[model samples]
Target: MAYTVGEMARRLGVPASTIRYYDKEGLLPFVGRSSGGIRVFTEKDFEWLRIIECLKKTGMSLKDIREYIELAMQGDETIARRLALFRKQRTVLETRMAELQQTMDTLDYKCWFYETAAAHGSTEGISDLPDEALPEALRPVRERLRAAAEAETEEV
Candidate 1:
């Protein structure tokens, strides 16, 4: 079934301008337009938008996404290239996920630190506390920070 741009955007939970920007950026080559110059969307277009959103949220740039879409439009013979692009993106995303996990771990430790300090009515001597009191998952973050501090002391 055909849909207008606004209807499609509302259904997809993105701003209409985002859809227009994708069209302008040539990332929506499969999207059609009406005789009156309005965007004409279909169920297929919705699927395309979802794929575009996935690539975008996973940190793929507009240029690379356009390249992937161009390859996709070239039919079945370009399957390998598309697969390679997705595989490369997957690796990049995995690295980013690892980094984000480390960040979350650090934040998790900070939250516990503040909570423990609040419970004690002061943050004093908390750093001298043992790792046995910490969540096991946070021990690595603690070790990493301690290593960094030692490295800095050595540099000085």
Candidate 2:
């Protein structure tokens, strides 16, 4: 079934302007134009939009995504190249995920630390607590924070 740009945008949970911008950027080349100049999207266009959204969320730049789409348009002969591109992007995404996980772990540790402090009247006795009182993973982070504080005090 053919869908107008607004209908497609509503179905996809994106703004109509986003769909129009992607169409202008040639990202939705599979979508056809009506005789009256309205964008007419097929089910295939929805599938293409899903791929575009995934790539965008994975931090792929517009130019690179456009190149990937061009490769796709070149037919089965470009299958190897497309596979290679996806593999490279997968590696990038894995690295990013790892970094984000590490950041989240640190944030979780900090949250626990602050909550402990808040439980007491003040933060005065936090450092005096034993490492066993905190999560095992947070030991090194706390040590680093303590060393930095000591160094700052010494410098002053």
Candidate 3:
């Protein structure tokens, strides 16, 4: 089915301006114009927009997204290049997810430590837990947790 730009944007939960921006950036290859120069979109447009949203969410820059779209418009000639680009993006996102997971794990551990220590009324109990008890990557979290715990004790 065909849809106006505003209708499509509403359905997608994105700003109409963003849709216009995508068109202006040449990311929408089949975008059409209405009689009064307004934008007209089809179901395929919405589908493509969803793909664009996914790419953007996966951390692709607009320039790269446009390049990908340009290559996509070329059909099968660039399929390998597109696959390679997406693979590279996937690796990046995976690395980011790993780092974020480590940070979240560290934060969870700190929260648990603070809760437990507070219940016992002493941050000193955590002193001998060893500097490298957790990942070296967690050292920063440990320091932040220690400082926060100390500050809380002082406030008490």
The residue-by-residue lDDT of candidate 3 on 31-130, one tens digit each, is: 8888888778988888889999999998988998898888888899999999988998899899989989867977777776677579779878665677
Which 10 residues in a row give candidate 1 its minimum summed lDDT? 125-134
Between candidates 2 and 3, the one scoring higher on TM-score is: 2
TM-score of 1: 0.93
Q: Highest TM-score, which number?
A: 1
Give all TM-scores, in the order shown.
0.93, 0.87, 0.78
Task: Give the range where candidate 2 is weakest over 10 consecutive residues by summed lDDT.
Answer: 101-110
Number of backbone collisions per candidate: 0, 0, 0
TM-score of candidate 2 versus the correct structure, residues matched by position: 0.87
Better of 2 and 3 by lDDT: 2
76-148 in candidate 1: lDDT tens per residue?
9999999999999999999999999988988998899899999999999877789998889888898997898
lDDT of each: 0.92, 0.86, 0.84
lDDT of 2 by residue, 37-131 (tens): 87889999998988998998888878878889999998999999989888888989999999898778779777987899999867898868999
- Top-scoring candidate (lDDT): 1
